[model samples]
Target: MNPNGPLLHFVIAAGLLDSFNPCAIAVLLIFIALMFTLSKNRSAILSMGFVYIMFIFLTYLAIGLGLLKIITIFSIPHLIVKIGAWIVIIVGLWGLKDTLFPGKRNILAIPIGSRQLIASWATKATIPAAAVTGILVGLTEFPCSGAVYIATLTLLSSSTTFLKGLIYLIVYNFMFVLPLIVLLLIAANRMILEKMINLDEMNSDRIRVISALIMIGIGIVILKWFV
Candidate 1:
């Protein structure tokens, strides 16, 4: 195996898990439905979707950089990573609980109170509306699905330089928004919205399980790295 294989695995896996966040996808689905209803032209909807994805990408990249800086400022970056790894483990366990006993409420998604707000904003569905909704979703969804991102940033803070870190962030964010881009394409083609929503609802639990597994795997790798 290549020397950087583990790092590559962690980054890509994290990005993929984050990308499949069901809560974010739910918001995106709603956004798409609203856009379809609000705008007559498919091109306008695509434009709005692109703008929304861009905001999410930029916001997440900025957040990652900010966290990376904080991690670097710490005197004991390795120790901090270890602690963060443990936190990631806990996060994974929580995800597992949600997956296994899905009815139980968890801290891994947007609050019920905020769902109404997100829906309200997304209902506007114009370019500016999409932009604002994108910012809101990106910021709000962080606490719900940010473990993989946090773990990755912590690891990178101690292990890589700034330019490399930026590149990794770019890759991660690209992967993060990829699913949304695809969904936008489907919507632009005027596919059945109800089917997509139904599909997401059916798989949301599985998404949680997969995310938990990947997070646990990353946590284990981090511990082994320290060993």
Candidate 2:
């Protein structure tokens, strides 16, 4: 079997699912709203949004590279891949619980203190502040949405060279941020932005359910084939 084929499919599917993560989308909406209040110029808002998203891409890519390096150095990619697959399954179940129960303690959420800090940075509406906020979001949002990422990295580490894995990581992270890029593009129009926000809110639970299922499915596949 050609491993790259299934891996590529998984990368694209998992990346798209991760892109709609409620945590990242919620933070993005908040940031866009704050940006609207801070600046009336559409160009300024877009510029800041671009910077914010660029930082998010960079941060996530860096983390993937770093983890891949560590896994390579340790020469335990197969073990780690198996462990990551189980973790992905667990995270999917946890997500489903959070969706169904709707109030149980969620250890996967961004910390309140970190959220407050991110809010403060969002309020600044400066490029540097946007960069910092993006970095913070990238770090803090992982627990909420990083199971797929870990699964991808583990699989990559086990089956591909670092260079090939790096290429996949770049593509995966790009797909991961594609939704945010779309949101940023439409953010200049208040009515459209509000509609998108409304849709996101209305379908948030459905999205979670779908994402959970995908994660569980991917984990099972990894355990069955890649492990």
Candidate 3:
């Protein structure tokens, strides 16, 4: 596994930025609720939750590997990354604009429907206890963050092996999941969760804006070295 040294910082920032995302933060709240409902054994719930997240990590690993293979085959890894940078930058700007300008909500995404698909995928995995966890974990791979991750991995494919791609993906997911795991253990109580969810919702738009700016910055970072 390539050390991809200190990409950890970028991935952690990405994860925290992801937490600020409305869907991500809300799903974490939902997971906290599920954690309470799923088991009275805190250890079991936490164990299952980690396993649940591992399952997500593995699934995305497959995706990252596939993307790397495709890019390596095409001999356009850097180009793929550059394209991804543009996409990340644009998505970030759009989210920022949406929050700052209060645009007429032209976006009509179906979050619940997507959640149902995630639920179905989880159930099909045959681990019923992990179903909700799958849904929650899956939601974090939204358009913006997912695009950035995908693009970066694809671009690296030319230089990184398939194993490295998988490793980087694993790192990204670990960092991404850490916050919720820590928070759930410390503040799984309904009052705390509700307060977090409410506060998250109130500031979600601003979070989106900030996340967008970050994405834009990351995009520029990638493009800078290339140019």
Name the best candidate (by lDDT).
2
Select the stronger candidate by TM-score from 1 and 3. Answer: 1
TM-score order of candidates, best first? 2, 1, 3
Candidate 1, residues 126-217, lDDT tens digits: the string is 77877888888888888878887888888887777776778788878888898888878886655767788888789877877877777788
TM-score of each: 0.89, 0.91, 0.77
Which ten residues in a row are the worst by lDDT in model 2?
102-111
Model 3 whole-model lDDT (C-alpha atoms) = 0.60
Worst 10 residues of 3 by lDDT: 103-112
C-alpha RMSD by candidate, in order = 2.6, 2.2, 3.9
Model 2 alpha-carbon drift over 4 Å, by segment: 1-4
Best by TM-score: 2
Stronger candidate by TM-score (2 vs 3): 2
Mind sharing the TM-score for model 2?
0.91
RMSD in angstroms between candidate 1 and the native structure over all alpha carbons? 2.6
Local distance difference test values of all predictions, in order? 0.79, 0.84, 0.60
**Error in Å for residue 53 of model 1:** 0.9
lDDT of 3 by residue, 58-150 (tens): 655566666667777775666776787787778777777776777656121225566666545444323454745554556445453565665
